[model samples]
Each structure stands twice: as structure tokens, then as C-alpha cells.
Target chain A: MRNPLTEAFGIEYPIFAFSHCRDVVAAVTNAGGMGVLGALAFSPEELEQELTWIDEHVGGRPYGVDVVMPVKTLDRDAGIDDVSDIGAQLRSHISQDHWDYTDRILTEHGVDVAARDDGLEEGAGLGAGVLGWTAATGAPQIDIALSHDIALLASALGPPPKAAIDQAHEQGVKVAALIGRVEQAQRDVALGVDIIIAQGYEAGGHTGEVASMVLVPDVVDAVDVPVLAAGGIGGGRQMAAAMALGAAGVWTGSIWLTVAENGSSPVVTEKLLGATSTDTVRSRAYTGKPARQLRTAWTDAWEAPDSPGTLPMPLQFILNSYASQKMGATPPRELVGMPVGQIVSRMDQVRSTKQVVVDMVQEYVDVTERLTADLEG
Target chain B: MRNPLTEAFGIEYPIFAFSHCRDVVAAVTNAGGMGVLGALAFSPEELEQELTWIDEHVGGRPYGVDVVMPVKTLDRDAGIDDVSDIGAQLRSHISQDHWDYTDRILTEHGVDVAARDDGLEEGAGLGAGVLGWTAATGAPQIDIALSHDIALLASALGPPPKAAIDQAHEQGVKVAALIGRVEQAQRDVALGVDIIIAQGYEAGGHTGEVASMVLVPDVVDAVDVPVLAAGGIGGGRQMAAAMALGAAGVWTGSIWLTVAENGSSPVVTEKLLGATSTDTVRSRAYTGKPARQLRTAWTDAWEAPDSPGTLPMPLQFILNSYASQKMGATPPRELVGMPVGQIVSRMDQVRSTKQVVVDMVQEYVDVTERLTADLEG
Candidate 1:
């Protein structure tokens, strides 16, 4: 029960649940572990409102905010000029064939392409494809996040920039970076990150090549800081395995996406619940980054020979954001597949976030007991 | 074009070609990678003769012999008689209900019950019962192998005993152990192993719980010495991935069984070629240890609800050895399956070990070039 990670975070359990839903975040932190609201799906103004809601609902529980600032992106040098120039550059990169395929698939699935499109400019809708890493451009969002009492600032795609680390540390907030390899862990350590999240490829969203079983220990060994194991970890048995491999705590994302408080459309939750371990694939169809997502007709279409490959990073996200927003509202059966990992297979039913955390901890204790018996026997 | 692994071993590639047949061993060694003859199925004297034949044919090319010298076994405390007693114990453990189900299934498949009760023990006709990790008591066998000038000693289950490591080191031969986790790699290092073989669960034969993509880098980071990546490495792209993840070399086992020079029966080779990655499963039906093998009716029957759970270690192996030997000699379509890893899906053709090795190196080059180009671009 003495979790070093929870101690470090001033929480009850080391569990840090990453979810887009504010209710799930509040529920987890209130139960014990820290709840981290995923800010990737929200605009700066929207995220401020969500943080305000969490602050009101969490009742003084320490919580964190997660951002999608990546160290590398497609067209890293593409400067943010006036809005029109940025919008024009992004549009030029989207191929006609890719748009046609997206249109065809969404239309075939009974989604209204014209209504969703609305001749929007770049970075349209509730969630725009903003490159998380460019600190000068993203600094305002970070400033807005720091204005609230967010306990942790996390960069999902790579090590948070030195400025972000310094800014968070200056504000007395913990800085965390997600890494998939040992070299990245070493770099994060050198960059003075307070926490290293060893996110395996089995995790949802942009992940590196390593799996949790190997990556957790590799990161633990590579850095002196506490490591949180992420990816394909939904149960206590997996949490025990990660701890045994050297992780101080478990950082879970996909498991929360199916929780009762999760706002992921029932259609996406149904896909996650009904899926098996093999139903997920690491593809660049969503964000032009290798993200583990539910394997569906959309992914299959992207993989087809007739289709042009996915565009790079923010551009690809821009192309798909409209369909994702539409799907979220309309809940298409075939065209919608949410980002999730292989842990989706084990999610046979929905439960309260509190129950998920409690069951995982209980399972972890049982697994350790069994392993102890094996070793002693 | 220069393979550092091959250069280190002074062979064509870092490839340690493992085979049960002496002729194939000789051929692989003569072609470059050291042909390591699987000595588990051979008696000490028989193995001596097999090594003698390989020595004569290899023309002084450095070759080795592989023994199933598990660090622990079912009858570790018991001698040969104790092994037999364990077999009797296993028979008692199998309930009549399970036996009746197996009988019914075999009978339904037109397999005779009388044949099932045939005078042969439960295993491949090679011998009755499982091959116990006799390597501890297998001094004579080790002595025989040493007499033939083997350059390396490898144990799949655990570190070869300190004496074995010392003896091999004394003879200027390297000691290698297969590990499935980072902790195991550290253990092997502390035990003074010269080479650490990080075999992922995707590998055939006895394996630990971790998959290769995660296991390799963890082992590499855990140990001080060079680590050879094994499991699911059947081609250049995979080899490249392994090296990119920080492997010194790649160790291939399943791919060799499908090689042209490998003496695996045509029926077995055809089954292997036809099988895909999903066609393999990790089951303890063949050996007490979890091994990935071709999914067959025999394995299915053993895993069914009516069947008793597998016996522990060597005892389970003893019950199945007679059937395995029979299947090995003339692989029946319904009952035969070979110890193979996930890479079996890629083993779609029979090529010479030399050709395979050459192709892997070429592919490694192409893959590295691509990764470097992507980064640079």
C-alpha cells in the first residue's frame, strides 16, 4: 500500500488515470490515485473550463493536466505566421485522395460530411490539431494551465521542453514526460524531468516501439527517477508484473476510457469492450504518429493500396478531426474507432473508476502473493 | 555488409544455427554461422558420434552443441529412478475423466486407443518420458562435447551451472543463457555468463513471460555484456529492428527448422511453411515449460477442459515424449506439431542457411539506411 509514486505525488495510490472526461479524473483522485485530464482533445479555453469544473468537483484532491506537446512533428520548421498562412500551409499538405477516402468512408457510414466540414479553416471545432511541442506558440495554453492549481504538467509525445520543465517546477508543479525507449529515459533524466512515464507501444496515442513489460524496467534502469509503467496495463496482474520489472507505479489511459464516468461515446466503449487483444493495431491513420487504436474499417481503409498514406502529424490530425467530432456526436458503428490499447480486450464490462482502481490494487496483491508462493516453494 | 555479430563469433553471421540433425549442423557451420546441434534428444554416446560426424564434415568451422540443461527441473532432487517415480506420480494426477475425453477425441479422429496405449512411453519415439535437465548430471555428455572442440555452451532454461560456465571458460569457450526478462539478464550476468541470449516469449521452446520487442532492450540495458536478440527474428527487417533496439546480434531457431538443409520431415516443413504467426500458441502440453509450438489437435486435446492440466516440468514432458517422437518420425496431419515461434509465419520457403543469413544482413543494412534517412530528412 506504500506506493512511492503516490507519496511523490501526494496522493493515496500511484495510479494516474489519463482520461478526457473530467468526472473520471475527479472520481479517481477522490478515490485515491491522481486523476489526469487529457487536454489534447480540448481547446485552451475549453480546457480552462474543464479544469475549473474539476477544481469545483474534486473537492481539493490533487489532480494533473496532460498536454500533447511532442518534441518532434511533421514539418517541425513550419513557422506559425498569421492564422491564414498557417491554415493555408496545412490545407496544401492534405491530399485530394486522402480527403476523398475519408469522405467516402464517413458518407458510407451515414455521417454527414458536408455538415461536419462546414468549410472550416485550419484548427476548427472543439478540438483542433495543435502541435503540442512548439512552446512559443503553446506557451499561452501552458500559462492558462498553470493559472489553475494543476499538480502536474505532462507532455505525452516526448520530453517536455526545458522551459516547460522549468516553468512547471517554478510554479511548484511536477513535470512528467512520456518515453518509449531507454535512450529517451536517459534524455529525460538529463533534462531534469521529475517523472518518466514509460509508455509502451501497447498504449493508446503516440507510442514508441517498446512494450510495457520491457520498457518499464529499461526506463527504471536508465534513470534514477521513479518510473510509471504505461501501455497494455489494465489489471492488477499486469501492474504487479510492471512493479516486479521495476516501475514505481502504473500510469493507465485506455482502461479509464471504458469507465462509467468516461464520456467516450457508447459506440466507442462498446468497441473497446467487445474487442480482443488482436483487435488493436499501431498505425499512423489517426495523427500521423504510430498510435495503438482499435482496428476497424477506417484503419483497414487507410491500409488499403488505393489510399494515399496518412499525412504527417498535425495535418493528419486536422484531416481526421472533423470526422472524429461528427462520429463522437452521431456514434457511427463502422467509421468510428477510438484510440485504445490491447488492454481494451480485457475490458469486458464498464465499471466505476473507483472500482477499476480498487480491483487493480487487489489483483496486484493477489498476484504478488502467488508469485511469492512460487518463489518460496 | 559487415555483420559485427558474425565477426565476433568468427562465423558467417552471429547466427547460432540450432538443429536436432547432425548433417544440418555441419552444413550451417560450413556455410558460416556456427551450427549448434541439439543434443537433448541424443544420449551421451550418440551425441558424441553426432558431434564427431559434424566435426568431420565442417572442416574446422567453429560449431557448438546445445543441451537442455535446465537450471531447475521436476526431479532435480531425484536421480533417474526418481524421474520414473515422478512419471508415476503424473499418471496418478491425471483424472479418469480427462483420460476418457482424450480417448474419445483421439478415437473420433480415427486414432486407435490401442495405439494410444502402445508400448511406447508418452513422448516422441526418440525416448520414453521427457529429457530431464540431465546437464547437471550430464558431465559425460559435456565431456563428449568438449572432446569435439565446441566453442560455445548454451542452456535454454537458465544459466548453465557455475561449473559448466567455468569448464567452458577454461576451455576458451563462451557460456550463453536464454533470458525472458531484465531480472533474468542481471541474474545471468551475476552468474558470469559470457553471452546473454534474450529470448522473447515469441520464441519456440521454453520461454519466460515477456515478448521480444520489449524483452531485448531491457536485457541489453540490464546486462554489461553483449546481448543477442532471439524470438520472432526470421528476416532482415526484424533483425534490423532488434539491432536498432540495441541488440549486438540476432539468434534464430525456428527459421532454421525450415531451412533446406534441416532434416525436419517434409510434412513438418510443409506445415511450418503453411502456418502463420497466429497459428502458434504457448502451451505446456509438449514440455512442462511454456513453449510456443504449432497449434495442432494434439495440443488442443491436451488443453481441453476434460484434460488434466499439464504435469510439472519433466513429468509433463515424460507423458508426451513418446507421442512427440512418433510424430517427429512421421508427422501425422492431425497430431504433429513442431516447436516453433511466431516467426514461423515468415518461414514460407525453404532456403539455405547461408542464403537466409545473407538476406538478413542485407535487410539490416536497408532498414538502418531507411531509419537514418527518415531522421535526417
Candidate 2:
């Protein structure tokens, strides 16, 4: 478990957990692996509350925060001065055809399209569509994260703005960026990123086309920073595979969604638990860019020939915000899906985050030992 | 190095090389790693000739032959009695719209589409479409292969038919099948497959949706047979990663294409050498099934909006057979691409097959030792 990353982060193991649930983040941090809280769905105030809770619960252990600052967004030049108004501004860009198609899909699925309220609170559990996706929204989250006792700050998409990287470095917080390509890794390294999380195609949320087995080592060979292998990595065998591919640590996202301490809706949790690796698809139906998520009727509707295509980043999520809320309120079993990697097949149990960490470490040790024995014999 | 696969195959290392070149196959076998020649492109007589050459070259070393016995093919029920006539019979099924679109694409690319002749010898270097794809074409190749001293017989597309499996077993030849899904692995094992090659999404040629990091372990857990990890594996580090993920050996394809002994055209070899991992795409342009190949003009033309969508298996290949020969003859640099994996980026040098095997073994040892040191400390 001892590596450059483990020593630098002062963690017992090199397992990095990414979760949107603050409880899961705190539990992983308390269990010796560093848990990173995803800040994409949270407002500045909500993020403050979550980080404060994590800081209090970790008992001085180090934890991190992950923010979504997409390099390219439809609202980047929309001239929306107020971050609160950005969501509304982006919603206006959604085409009427897209809306009509989306509604038709829900209607066909027997979902009540009119059930969603016009208030922000209705979209709470389904994720805030335009929140923290642009600089205007993400800057405040970064400011709040740096103000806290965070050990690392990760950007989920593209390289973090240089100014923000400098600000994080000034605050003694290490900056990490998730990249799916070797060119992106080089660009991130040039921008002074302290770590590179090479997320592969089999990962949840946004991912590149390359898989972890190839992407991890490619990024490792292309950059000088410690590379954390993300995507399709769930348990100890995968963790060992990442290490074998020249990764300093393993960055896992989907495995945390089904943990006992997490608060994922029962429907989504059950789907994830029952899914095989083939149950996921890399589609642009949810986000504007391709992301690996559980294949659902919702995704299928977007992929149908007659359906209107997805809109670009801030706009697509904005269009999805309402349907997401409706689905959250009364989940259609076939339409309720969350972001998950190919590793969903391995997450069959609802163990505590601490137990998951223990099992992964145990399995990693057993695999490495077996491999070592092969060399000796 | 000393896994069950190595002991069973009597190879010095657990490296399995897949190539269409007989020279590359024999060279790999002589280097102590078993080589499996792709039999999809050859007639029974050609395969016999190739196998006889390999037998004389390898000094009685163990090697294998790979045939494409697709469980479902367009000609499965075509009622074509003669294997030689199967190609022409299936070619008639190609629609006029597809032919015009193909010609338009070639013409747009400065290629003279009418230059392609109607002779069978013209399609020699480019893969023979409708050849060895169905049982009519493959059964004879299997017979020729069994007549030789082949150590193993592998099915590249589907599980070899039960009769073929029985015949191979009766001849004391072990059977292997390449699968992208865990369910496929289970099905192959039930049908008496001796070895399972869990080919991942990042692999060259036809592959499934799952990547090797996840698919290998999933298949390993589902089946009792030894598994060979394929896709996105080119070097020793990748070999180590496959081993860490519980694969008994490494099955490599794209790496062999760039080796000095391979007979790939200079244009394709140069393009492959210069390609990054992202330079390839899992496209259905060349083969109707999704296969990972270089992102070339040929693939792009087939994917264009105005282009008629590709046809199913044998028909699509048959449609491209003329264009393939033309491209091979004129050497359209952009259109002369071949099947390749994401690891094409790693094939920067033109090393001999023997050197490639030695380098892989050395790197595997180095990586395992480094991991062993991590455990020891």
C-alpha cells in the first residue's frame, strides 16, 4: 500500500474514493482511504455545509473535494452575471423540439411529465443541472473548498483554470485533473496540476474512449505527475491491476454509490447491485459529452432515431433537470439509473465504506502476493 | 511466467501472439511464446500452405491457429453447398445503394473505384470476405488445421460449433474462444471451450463492450478454464496488468502487426507506428460487427451522414472486398489502415518478433519485482 501517493497524502492505502454523498466521503476518510466529495450538484452554501460536516467527522484526517469546471460549456459566453440566474439562462437555450421529444418519451414510459415543480428544491436529489459546471458557479465552490481543510482539489472535466490551480497551490491544496487522453495529461501537467486522474471509457460520468488498462499506463508514460487510475476499478484485483499498469493509486467512483453509508435512492441502488458489466453504456444522453452510466429506458429514448439529439453541456443537463426530478419523485424502474462504471457488476453487497476499504486492501495483498510468488518460483 | 498456461502449452512465458502472417506466427513460436495465425482470410488450401510453412519454420515448437466461425452469419442458411461459391452467392445480396455509396466515397477520396478488377487473386492481401466466416468456409480450414500439429484451435468471433469442438478434442487439440462478455465466456465453457480469451473493447478487430481490466476478472470468476487476457495489451507492463487481473496469459494482436516479421503494407505500418491510443475507434465500418481499427478515411467515409449504413457481417466485408484490393494496390495512405488496438501508440519501433517477446518478458519480470518490493516493504 505504500507508494508516493500514500506517503504524500498521509493515507494508509492508495485508494481514492469519489462520491457525491458527504457521509460516504467522511466514512472513507475516517477509514484510512481518502474520500473526495463531488461538488457538481451542490450550491456554494450547500457545499459549505457538506465540507463543514466532513471536516468535523473525519477527526483531522485528510479528505478532498471534486468540482466540475467543464472547459467547454454552452453558457461560457452567455453573459449571465449572476450564478443563480445561469441555470434559468441555459434552460432558455433548450429547443422546443427537444422538449417535445423528452415529454413524449416520459409520456410513453407512463411517467407524469407535469409532476415536476418550477422550484430548485424539487431537483435536489436528481442533481442541479447547471450548478458548478461553469466558471461562474465553480469559482465559488473552489473558493469554499480552499477555505476548508481540504487536502486535494480535483476538476472532473478538462484542466482547471491556471488561476485556480495557482490559488489551490497557494492554499497548500494539491490540484488534480481527470483526463481520458494522453494529450490532456500533458496539458494538465503543463498547467501545474499536482496529480492526474486518468479516467477511462468504462468509468462513470464523463470518460474518454480509452479503457483503464491502457489509459492508466499511457497517462503515466506521458506525464510526470502521480497518475491515479480511474474507471472499471472496483475491488482489490482491479486495484492491483492499476498498480501493475504504473499507477500510483486507484480512483474509484461507482463502487461508493452502492455502499451502505451512501444515500442513493433504493431503486438506483438495486439496479446498480444487480447490473452486470454489460449493463452500462457510454452515451451522451445524460451529459453533453459521452459518459458511462447504467443503460436505462431514458437513455434509450435519447438514442432512438426519431428523438431529438442531446444539447451541449450546461444546456443538456438543464433540459434533463426536470425529467430527472420527476423520475426521482416517482422512479420508473426501467428509467431510474445513475452514473455507474463497468464495475457495477462487482458491487453486489451493501457493505460499509470501511468494510469495502478493508476488503479491497485484503484482496490487493492476496493478488500481489500471488503475483510475487509467480516471480519467485 | 510459470502459470498453468505456460506449463500446459510448454512455452517459456505466458504470451500468446495473434497474427495473420505465417512468418510472424512461426517467429513468435520460436521465441518461446505461442503464436496463433488468424485463419479468416485464407482458403483451406492457403491455410494448409501457411501451416506447412510454419511447421517447417518453428522446429516443431507449439503454435495455434485462429478461425472465424461466427455463430450467426448471413450465409448460415444460404444453402450454398460449395465453400468457393459462398463468396459470390453472398456478394449478390449487397444492395445497389451500398455499392454507389462505396464508390462515391472512394471517388471523393481521389481513388478510382472502377480500377478494381473482378478477379479473386486481386483480393489476396486484403482479407477475403465471406471466407471462413460461416461453417461452409470454416469447416474445411479447421480440417486442414487439425491435419497439422497445431497445439490449439481458437474461434475469433463465436464459440466454435459443438461438432468442431468434439472433433478438435478427439484430435487432442485444445479449443479456445474469444469473448467480450462474461455470459459468452460461460457459454463457451459449457460448449467445451478449453481456454477463454476475454477480448476487451480496446482490442483490435472484433471486440465487445467490456474492457479487459473488468472483463478478464469477470470471465475468470465465471469460468473454470484458464483465461488469456486480450485487447489493449502490447508491452510487458500490460502483460503484468493482465496477470494481476487473474488472466493466465496475454493474447496480443495489434502489437504483432507492427513487428518486423509481419507482412503489413508499408503505409499501414507507418500509420500504425505514428498512431496514438486515441487514433483508433471501435467502428462497424470494416466489419459489420463493432471492431477496433485505425481511424482512417475508409472508416470515416463509412460513418459519414450521407453514407449508406454498413451491412451485416459477411455482406459488409464482401462489399468492401473490391475497395480493399484497390486501396492495397494504390496504397491510399489515409485509407490503408488495418485492425489495431489502443496499444498502437506503444508500437513505436520496428523490432523483430523475437526481440518483442524478449522485451515483454523482461518488462513483465521488472514490473512484478517492483510490485513484490511494494508488498515486502
Candidate 3:
């Protein structure tokens, strides 16, 4: 599809795939769609190494970098110079009562909260660097990302700061912000975002209650820039729906979670494949904000009446860091969960990212052709 | 626009406008889109009169009947012979404390519970013939509707009972059922439903949590029958989105609430027109199930912790019946509300139903052409 998205990003298809795994990124980029790597998961050094590997493997195709620099995140307005200052502030805010409650819930669920030594040894316990919640840390990541050749920069929660936007624009990297509400879309556009990813409530992580059908057209109407539709978009039909709602393209995340190159744990992959759409819930247990995820024992426990409430944003991430590492590495790994959209029900098997793109484009073409015939006749 | 929905219903556009008022149904049907009158709001005799008025005014255009024959309702399996029997059973189940709480909340909000004499005089209080909820009630409505010249019949909560389906089919009227989940789509298909209304969470009235972007494709894939996408479809962009998701047509409800031909009160229409997507909530306070409605004092009061919890289905309706009539017709009318989709945010003015249909078709044509050009390029 040769929409503005394809032309702006210089890709063959308008499908922009987001994944944490470099393998999926390289595969998608090489397959003619833009592959956006979730760079918040990697440190500066690790990100450099991963980018070098991708540059070597991608054959000079266009791809993007996704960073988590929420405008209203914890310590966002602290005017901090260093990531360490923000980390210290974040740690100080999480009460001991919340920590004790986490311990109680994890222990009750037979999760090995006691095996947190490995996390501390690996410096996983909250300190200078945690999940990319602070702009202080995210700015460095952006600097690292700009140090490389990338096509787009996508901010998940809100519009990236002026410095980040300007820096990306300097490198010819078009900037995008994902928004759940029309007001956010208007703000993002006014802030000079090149693209607005209008994600509906059905999306995987950090979603609002507005569904895509309503949210997409609202965002499209509110913004001057081209929009990319996200949330519950996995196939060609959904991509076409996005276009019908006046979006230039589709920004996909959950569909990549089970791709053969995604490199998620086999247990997690199997659970996702077997899960139905009803098996998911919007829970704040993981990220301290409402995110659609696989309903698991871990999420269910946090929702119970006896359990303590979750902390907000960075505090919740800080508290979750210690136990999250253990849960992934533990035996059985029953409580292991990740953010996924309602489209997980459709991801019944593992396929190459290339095949996924090919199938989607083909189906999108056929469906559109049929619709055109219906319209004309 | 010339899909199976058009062919099956003998309409020009594949847009099915649903409203309780005869004026809207007649106006929409005369304007080339099929207008399905919501028959649940009227008794058999009243519905006959409404249908006769529509038939006289609609310029020989086709229309349909929407009966709320939810397979499982409050008194579904009681083998109830009449609405009185069901209403009596429903009243018996509602505790006196609950009634007192309802009375207290309404009076405190300046709603006159004693001013419902007009409703009693007009036969608005529950008795022999109420809105469609049971086979006993819906069957008679179906019989009356079949005696007319409707082109389609639809059930809301579940598959129409075998008798209803058979009766509709016998008259060559196609049968449809609205579904919120993929499982419900399959069940409806198995019951030989001709069309499936795959409504998403953004829809007004009783809806499930699944949004249209996910639910539409899931339902379209699960069933072999033609699917009509509903929920948040107030304009052409959303209708285009539905078609892209493999829906044969678009079933709309909320957009009609503010139409010039709709008979809703000016206060409720003003609230709907001024509201945003966030102003509505899926609360059990209204229909004893999660129904999206305008968040007025009535719904807010029932949701408050100090307020008594809502009784299930018919009980809640029975309890609210007295106060709701007063709240609508009395002086203040502050607590007046109605079912509306998230697209209620976009319904900023009152337009004639003909303009709505004409605008939708034109927009649909322009969008499909743009998408086709994009795909071809």
C-alpha cells in the first residue's frame, strides 16, 4: 500500500511492526514493512550492539525505534539531570506497605519472591536504570537511537519532549506519538508530531476505554497529520478498517508477540496461542496503569479484595522489577504474563514475520476488491 | 453499498438505521437505507399503529422489526404466560429495602416519585403487555410484525427462539441476532440466523467488553453468515471500517438518537449532543446489566456506594419504571438519559435522517475510492 506512511517511512507496505526482539525487527524490515524495535527494553550499550547487528542484517531497509518517555511519568517534571536522581526519587516514593503486599500475594501464589537475590546481583533492583519511565533515562536512549540510522521514532504514552522531537527531526527521523483519546491526538499534533498512532482501548498496553471504531475517526478528524491505527489490528481486514477510518497505516504490536522470530518463551507463546479474546483483561497489576493483558494468576491476585492496590507508573515499575525478573526465570513460570491485545485469539500459530505481512497484504487486497465490487454494483 | 444486506433487505444502502420512533424509521426507509423500528418500546396494538403510520409514510420502502427476545432474560424459563405473570415475579424478587432505597434516591435528587400517575394512566407501569423480554411477549410482537410487510427480523441478546425464527423464515423475512462475542456469533449461526450483528463495547445499551475492531473480524471469521458491524458506527468512516472488517452492512443506533425525526426529549438530546466519548459508562445501574448510557444523576446515584445495588434485569426495570417516567416528564429533568454509543461525542446537532444517509453514502464512496487508489499505487 502506497499511502503517506509508506512514502514517509520509505517502505513497501504500510504495516509498521513493533517488537522487542531484534530478529523480528530485522525480519519485518527486510520483508518491506517498517520494523520498530522497542528500545526501552535495552540499555545504551546493549541497544548499540543490537542496532549494529540489525544494520548488518536488514539490507538497508527502513525501520523505527520505539521509546517509552511518558510525558506525565514519575519524576517527569523533576528537571533532573541524571537517571540516578530520578531512580532515587522513584524508590523513595514506593511505600513499604505496597512492597509487603506484593510479597504476601506472590508468596500466597507460590511465586518465589525470596529468590530476588539474582535480580539484585544483576542490578535489576531499582536504581539508576529501570524500565524507561523517566525522560532523563529515555533521552539517553534517544541519543543512542539517533546515533544510528533509523526512519521513525515512536513515543508510546505521550508526545516526546521538544528536545527529543527536534533531535529526531534533525536526523530526518519522523516522530510519532501513540494516543488513546482525541484530546491527546490534538495535543500531539499541536506539538508538531509527524504522525499520531491512534490506539483504541483494544490495544495491548496502556490503553484508554475508547474503542478503535470510535477513537480512530475522532483522532483522524482532530489531527492535521496522518494517523496510524493500532489496537486489535492483526490482519489485512483490520488494516483496511484503519484506512477506512482515515488512517494512513496500521501500527501492530500483539501480532508480533507470537511470530516465530519474536523469541518469547515457549510457555508464553503456547499460552497466547491457546488463549481466546475473553481470556484477557485490562489490569493495572503489571504497569500500574490499565493495560490489556493475558488474565493470569498474577493479575488475578492483584485484583483480589485482600490485595493491596498497585502503585502509580514508575513506583509500580520499580516494585515490579525485583519480582518480575524472578517470575520469568522461575520453574513452571505459571504467573508469567505480558501485554497482549484482544487479537491474541487470532494468533493461533507461529509464522515467519514475512508470511504474516504477505498474508495480511493479500487478504487486505482481496477484501478491498470485494468491497469495491459491492460498492460499484 | 450493494452487498447481501442491501439485497436481503431490499434497500439501496447497506445501512440499517434503528430507532424507536416511527418518524425516524419512515424517514430513513424513504431515504434508501433500511430502517428497523425498535418494537420493544411499544405494545402489539401500539406497534401496529406505528407500523401502519410508517407504511403509509415510507413511500413503499422496506423496513424491519427489532424484537428484544433475549434467549435468556429475567423470566425466560419461568414458562410465563403473560407480561403480568413475569412482572409479578419480577416485583416479588425485588426486596422492600431496595424499593425504599430507590424511592429515597429519586426524592433526594428532586425527582417526584409521586408524579408517576400519568405513567399509570397511560399504561406505562408493568402489566399485561410490556416491552419484548420473554417468548410470551416477543412471540405476539413477532406475530404482529409478520402480519406486516417487514423484510427482516432481529433479536438482541441471543438467537431468536426456534418459533420466532421459523415464523420469520416462513414469511420470507431474514432473521438476524446481535452478538457481542465470537461464541455468540457461532451460536446464532448454528440457530440459522441469516445475519449477525457483531456489536462492540463502544455501542450503547447492553454490550460486552470486546471492541468492534476485534469483535467484528472474530465474529465474521467464526460464522458463515453475513455479518453487520454495530457499536460506535455513527458515520461513514465507521461504516467503511465495518465493511473492511468483512461486515456486509452497518447497523447503527446512537446516531439516530439526535436525528430530527427521533422522538427523544430535547433535554436528553442536548446531553447526548454535548457529551464526549468519556461521558458514557458501562454501568449495571440502568438495565441491571452493563449498558452504556449518558452518565446522569440517575446512573451516578445507583453506582454510589451508599446507594442500594441494582436488582437483576426486569426487577431493575420494574423498580426504575416509576421514577424514570417522572425524571423524564417533570420540571427539572436533570436526570434524563438514553442509550448512546461512544460516537455520541460526534453527534453535535440534529439532522434529518435523509441527510444522515446521504452524507454517509457520499463519504463511503470517497473513502473507498481513496483506499483503492492507495492500494493500487
Clashing pairs in 3: none
Candidate 3: Cα lDDT at B49: 91
Task: Give the least accurate 10-residue stretch of model 3 chain B, judged by summed lDDT.
Answer: B121-130
Question: Number of clashing residue pairs in every model?
Answer: 15, 0, 0
Give lDDT: candidate 3, residue A95: 83
**Model 3 residue A38 distance off true place after TM-score fit, in angstroms:** 1.2
Docking class of 3: medium
Cα lDDT tens digits for candidate 3, A1-377:
78777877788998999998899999999998989998878888898988888888988888889888776766765555465555566666778888788677678767776765653543554643355766667777788888888888898887888888998888898999999999998888888799999999899988999999989888888888999999999999998999999888889999999988888877899999998888889998877878899998878878886777887776776666767665556534557787899999899989999999999999999878877888888
Two-chain DockQ for each candidate model? 0.03, 0.79, 0.76
TM-score of chain A of each: 0.92, 0.95, 0.94
Interface RMSD of each: 16.2, 1.1, 0.9
- Which regions of candidate 2 deviate over 4 angstroms? A115-127, B77-81, B116-129
Judged by DockQ cut-offs, the docking class of candidate 2 is medium
Q: Per-residue alpha-carbon lDDT of model 2 for B25-128, expressed as tens digits?
A: 99999999999999888877788899999999999889999998887777776666565565556767778998888777778788876676567443432354
Error of 2 at A105 (Å): 0.7
